[model samples]
Target: MASLSFFIPALGKEPESIEDKIQLAEELKATDFNRFNELLKQVEDSSVNLTAEQHEQFRFLDAYRLAYSGSQTQAVANLTELVKVAKSEKVQFKSLSVLLNILIISRDYSEVFQYLEQYDQMQKNITDKDLRQHALGILALVFNQTSQFDIGYFYANKLSSDAVDGKYACFGMQFKLESLHRLKKYDEFDQEFDAGVATCEAAKQPIYSKIIQSYRVERLLEVDPNQAISLLNSLYQDVEQTSYNVLITLYKTLYSIAYLRNEQLDVAKEYGLSATKNIKEDDINYAILLLYSTLYEIEKANGNFEKALTYHEVLVSKQKAYDDEKAAGLLAYNIAKANVEVKNQRIALLDKDNELLSLQKDLYEKEARQNRLLVLILGAILLLATVLAYRGLTGRSRFKKIAEYDQLTGISNRYHFNNQAKIALDYCETNAKPVALILFDLDYFKDINDTHGHAVGDWALRAVVKTCRNFMRNNDVFGRIGGEEFAVVLPGCQTDKAVLLAEICRDAIAGIDTTESGKHFSLSASFGVSGSDNSGYQLKQLLADADSAMYSAKAAGRNQVATFSE
Candidate 1:
């Protein structure tokens, strides 16, 4: 689809379109500056009304420019903030793709894995075929880099399917080639590499073409150095990828390394020199280090002792500089993360302080009213003397039960349960003890509430809580998460023991007579159990596992206990 068009009256009333903006973005993206700042200023100055889709397109464009031009740290920072504003799924997918790629380039695999879930959730809502491919293409790249070859191949190949085609088509093909290479499927790699090369070249994506060449040449170096050299030579011959100087340097460095190993000292030195010439001051530290070391080794092989020594000293200096820079960057990232955490903590504290202040204000106002009533009855002097201490004390205690317990069941409420659950989990975790979390809900609870009455429903909930308390250990944390839902956290209990307890509780509830007098009826509930593996020990984790298990139990049949499946 073509981009929306507008006119800028100040610039000779020149016409501007999305293509014009994108072309400008590409030019600026090659530099270290914030891409499209000029265009951003121009757009802000223009009072053009953009449709929702047009607006979203510009958002995607801005993030792309940032991701392309900025450093990994800057890209991650900007994209993280952009995701919240990218309400459209297409825009969101594009922004997240850029973000995940930044993480990949930074080698933050754990964060990539963490974000896969977010991507999956977002993709589930996106029905646009191209957007789906865009999302899957990012996931495929992540899996490929993480060495999950089978999974990577599935998504990449799926994304490459012709049902979805666009600018991101190369991404799917790129991941397919990479994952196959890592899996050591050489024949498949060769085929995909050739196919990807054609597609990227035909599409005029020189950077993508260079990337394909880079990957293919790596495998060729192992099997046939001559063929690898031929391919690498072609890349340098046609190397208009000044925007991708990193790849050119990397390819050149690898070429030098390969020939140096093959005892072609003179040829290796030539390639090494070319590689060094490609290095930029702002290039990636690892690539710069590799190029220096590759050149250093080639010179050493050629028996130029003085030249080799000079290169060695340079390499050492660069390494230290890189290390220092890395340490500083990591410290900054950590400090930023800590600041966000502290900010959230302050907001929570302020909310709690505000609630307390509101409570105190209410109490003061009530006291003043009481004093005024007393004055109306027995003059101002006597009003001050008349103190109703009991009434004052009673008002404060009225909400005490609400804070600690479920009103209907007289058991712990969600707030108290969660608070105490965390404490119990922490203690068990520290002591190397087992802990199990069991979440359960009354089956057909609404049916009972509808057919019988809310009063009967309330009685049934109380009865269930009473029976659960009977089975619960004194140290166990038990509470109602909400209506018809309750949790029992057992410290020092393993999966089997927790499931056993759930079974016992289930049976006990089955025997509960939910009706009063002659209207007797039995009640049943489904239970879900989860135990910590020690690797993952947290209340929220356990609660989620147990909640999932309970739904499984409900699906199977009520009055049964289920533990989370692998």
Candidate 2:
């Protein structure tokens, strides 16, 4: 909370006190680059001095601004400076995460791997709860993207089990599902695939759930190509209900499968052209290539041999770009070297500071003599060592707790929830008191994401979580098990009371807004309540019963609650 202005460069005079400077930075007009650059120039020309921590924060914000402004390459250059000065695990981890994501978007895979290797080291050093968990999630995703399924699944499960928040746990579950699919463990895949689908649906993440379903088609195709086509056709209407971008990709894929089946030629032509038209030339993902490939087939079918040949060449060229091993490894060295340069710069700065202090002592403290100077230098070194040691101890404790809670929503994760709930349930059972469980799932969340986009969907999720916390007290335990699906354990509470609470939450969520930036939409959730009598409490049974009840609420109409009945 201290003023962070020491980080900003001053203008002509000493910059405003740290608080004013930071407040001014926060108030900058986000869209007006002219005003933004004017503020930056004033800082760059400022006369103010800065602490190392302040300077690091300033530089991090600066690079982030550049990335936000779409100057990604320059952002990378700016971020490189921060990396060089990276003494703080939190700062370095944050910077590396941003840089890696930008590189991924730029398809700078070579450098992504290099930074990833460094990221592994940073994640280990991180004790900050928020940063550590976020790093774990990012690490899992990056590894999954790069085809490291085993390692990906490990981190995914770690994030899911360790963090109980919705989005983060959902991502972990999604990664686990993908990793399992890649490993070809069909039995495990089948078991998790449904959960994955449910989470995605509960969370209103249609695209991800559809991808999970698509894997089943891939597996089906491996066994029977014709049947696979039939399978996709059966799901056509559902797939078409997705957002335009996702629907385009699905349609293109379906066109290819239909072509294989030697059926739906007209349908293929319709979808191919529709997908191709919707796609811009700059879109270079695999889906775009498939669209072109499909176009090649459609064109050939129409006797447009020349056009078909042209499309074929384009498709091959796009495919070859991916096969270009040389390109993938191109930037790995320079980007990795950037990490090393950071350590080198840190050492250089320390050496330079020490040299300056020694000179200053010689020039100004001659009367104080060499003995005093010697003690001064030695004392400073010892003090620095002491501070580092203290930080190390404190940081580890924070990191350990970070591992037990979801970073996104700040709730107990599945792992922690299980422990806490068991204790609570046992206490209730021993006292012969009834206990209740409430499970809530956001209704049609995917539509919010598909229509309003992910940011709004996220806002809705946080709103629901926050609302749940407001309605429940300290005695209750809440955790997010599936995406968009949350559970609360109310020890010594009966079904009637649980149902009342669930309805309260349901109505509260229904009143919340979806979007955050400007335009807004309403959101709602379905709730299910189940209870255990004086006999005992079993979490698994409660969850299953609650899920079914919740499903009934969803069927009857969302934004309502259903209680388990005999």
Candidate 3:
């Protein structure tokens, strides 16, 4: 909570020694930028002679300054090298912590977790009392941010119970309350809130105090509007004084939501507008969604349905973009991890080669020509085994891909579809979000297969898939569920939007160009839509209801969209 203090010494003034200067710099690094610069100058003075470890410490401090001062590129480049080559364990630990800090700021969570593993391993060798407390505090905060609340709660307790410093204790309590809030330990959170805020106040950290209060405000929004408004109003001055963009935005958003619920339309509109203007640059997606969502509610309450619809559309667009960005981050993280595994495997193979070479050398020194031949034969056999193992690995990977996707259309097959749909539905249910399912199939697929050949029918299916894919969001689940039937699961979609999307797909199907399949026949699909609002979040029930609706559409006429009704 003191900003990457796992390897930083406690603050002290008037340094009389190099160690004292380093300690003082660590103290001022996060709080007082100008003083940190002056301390850097004194450390870099020509008359002062510094040891190798001390020099590394100075570099660490310099990188910290660069990172906080908008020169993160150079800071990361320097810290990365220092993490590898620093002679002192303290400096190396500090480098790793700062590197993690930079990664977190950049929202490169994958690398943060990767480096977190390294930090976890290094913690065993670290013996400093303050450093251990800081490490626990950092772990608690990071885990909480990443939504690993149970682990965060565990570490927060450790940090708080073991902390000797009041500041560290306050930090531990702050994050512990955060974990409880996210974990939905409501009764516990209510019990802990006052103590957490009091501890932060005792430590003279109004910022942490404000953060704890914001959590209370968020909880109160669901239960007591007036109390939530009162808390938000009290929180406004502290948040403004801190000038922290994230807190400022959160405070305003909560204030607006509170006022909207309390029937103060003008005040809600004012704060909603102000909140949007204060969104942080690094993390705009989630903030924008929150701001727009509150504004949408406010507009709807004011009976300005058109403005509300516009805000709702903006909310949808922002959510899609956020989902895409999250997917890309996961992809990048997986790629990075895979690269590391490949490098480690290569090193392992080289080690085995070295071991084999040593055996061959031993045989040669013994002057056993026959044994040398035997060793060479064994080496060949080992190489053959390695090749076979590699083939087996690749073969399994190929089979896995085949098992998960429809061979003809390259979308999820029935089994994988069911699994993925369930996961999506579960997530939506957890968040109390709506979901909609669209079940459709070609109107006359059997007729098409009989009139033409299976080749043309297959081409038609693939074409339908391609057309439908265009209308789906990144988070939407599309799959081939049967011979001619397909399903699309749209999270956060209500029935009207689902029906609209189904109608669009139906039209698109009717308009598909048969020329691509080298045929001149028409195409059509019957669509059935069912949403959680009517059918609940169970996939089985949704699919069953959509199926009934599809048959109803077919009985009425072919190539029509039908919504599930009582």
Candidate 2 TM-score over all chains jointly = 0.48
Error (Å) of candidate 3 at residue 209 is: 1.6
Winner by lDDT between candidate 3 and candidate 1? 3
Taking every candidate in turn, the Cα RMSD to the unseen true structure, in Å, is: 20.4, 27.4, 14.5
- Backbone clash pairs for candidate 3 read none
TM-score of each: 0.46, 0.48, 0.56
Residue by residue across 1-566, what tens digits does model 3's lDDT show?
23545434446458877778777878777667798788788887832588777888898988888887899899999999998899899889878877887786576776776677678668668888777777787677667666678888998988878878888888888889988988899899999889989988998887788888888888888899899988777778878998877778888888888888888999999999998787644355444677889999999988999999999998887888777756655544444454455457667768989999999999788877656677776888878999999999999989998999999999999999999999999999999999999999898899999998899999999999998887677688999999999999999988987887787688789999898888789899998999998899999999999999999899898899999986
- Give the number of the best model, judged by lDDT: 3
lDDT (Cα, tens digit) per residue for candidate 1, span 275-383: 7776765555556797788778877777888999988988988999777655544444333343345456667768989999999999999989878757576775565
Name the candidate, 1 or 3, with the larger TM-score value.
3
Q: Write the per-residue lDDT of candidate 2 for residues 1-566, one digit (tens) a residue.
A: 00011112233343466534533553452344465555565555552665676567567767867887899989999887677777875667678877876876676777777667778788777766555666777777766666668888999888767754455556667778878988888898898888878876776766666677777876775567677777777766676786557555755576565654465677667767767766666556556766787778778877899999999998988777755633454334433454465457667768989999999988777756756766776888878999999899889978977878776677887788888889998898888888999988888888878988787766676778887786676678998776677889999888887886786677677776544545577778889888995224988888888888989998997788888886
lDDT of each: 0.71, 0.72, 0.83
Q: Decide which is better by lDDT, 2 or 3.
A: 3
Model 1 ranges off by over 4 Å: 1-82, 85-88, 98-114, 143-151, 162-167, 231-235, 240-243, 285-290, 303-566
Positional deviation of 473 in candidate 3, in angstroms?
36
Cα-based lDDT at residue 212, candidate 3: 85
